[model samples]
Target: MKKFDVDSKEVPIDILSDYILKNPEKIYGIHHNKMEELVGSVFKEHYNCEVHHVGMSGDGGKDLILIESDKSIVVQVKRRQSRSKTETASCVRDLIGATLLNGSRDCIFVSTADHFSKQSIKHKEDALAMEIIDSFELFDIDKFMGVLNLHTSEREKLWKELIEIK
Candidate 1:
């Protein structure tokens, strides 16, 4: 088995993917805050944005904030225990509210679940149509891995990482 420092400031996605394949349990067993950190790091690296982890009590619905020039994006992260569990509409609603309250123009809801409930997708579309939010994005485990540009093999490991927990 191979090992890499999960606590490192900048862990390359490929290396992290390799490590996850070798130790799926280790990645799946990370604390919620650590999962937020990992997600933040990926966004920072992939989008060249500054990420702030606001994962704590009374976070006001956002776990991470991404800043790119004049634009700031609020993000809510859901680390579900099971991939079969679907993220609900309320999560999207909370993120939308948080983005508006935070004075940001965009929001993203990230989840480890295999998918978001149809109601969640509808809520996001409704918010967009009403111009309640400038933009909203939902990222499941697959989309999360896509953002990191993980190869198919690496992406499979992520799915396995979630599955092993079940």
Candidate 2:
């Protein structure tokens, strides 16, 4: 198994890959639910902050909402691949725009694919009236798990052998 530390707390792999990947039946004999579950698990480990998952189903373009103490962070998970760089940048811009419309200045975008852009980073600062979110970025399943004080090890190979259906 993979191991690490998040905000002095140790988050297991269960809260990372199994939940974020939305595939638990093939994992630890359970089901995975809530986009916030993945987000919460990460922020909790990284910052030791209180968090919740609003989810994306019927909630428009947002996936999760994370709260760190008094400040609230509006989060969007782009866990799918984009056909091209333009599409990727558009998705990030759209997420930021929607969060701004909702009056949240702190916007975070998480994706399974590489969606990092220079334009997003350039807009990290704003006037006193607005909150500028350059980006709260995360990429790759392994890195996500790392954020949660978790890891995927050689044990994953064994898991695949045992869990793969015939």
Q: How well does each candidate superpose onto the true structure, as a TM-score?
A: 0.77, 0.55
RMSD of each: 8.4, 10.8
Task: Estimate, for each residue in 1-166, the C-alpha lDDT of model 1 and write its tens digit.
Answer: 6554665535565566556556554454545776787788777866679999887999999899999888999999887766777988888878888999999979989888889999999999999999888888899977886664555354568789999999
Model 2 spans with C-alpha error above 4 angstroms: 1-36, 81-87, 115-143, 150-166
Q: Candidate 1, after superposition: displacement of residue 107 in Å? A: 0.4
Which candidate wins on TM-score? 1
Each prediction's number of clashing residue pairs: 0, 1
Local distance difference test scores for all models:
0.79, 0.52
lDDT of model 1, residue 103: 96
- TM-score of predicted structure 1: 0.77
Candidate 1, residue 141: CA error in Å? 0.8
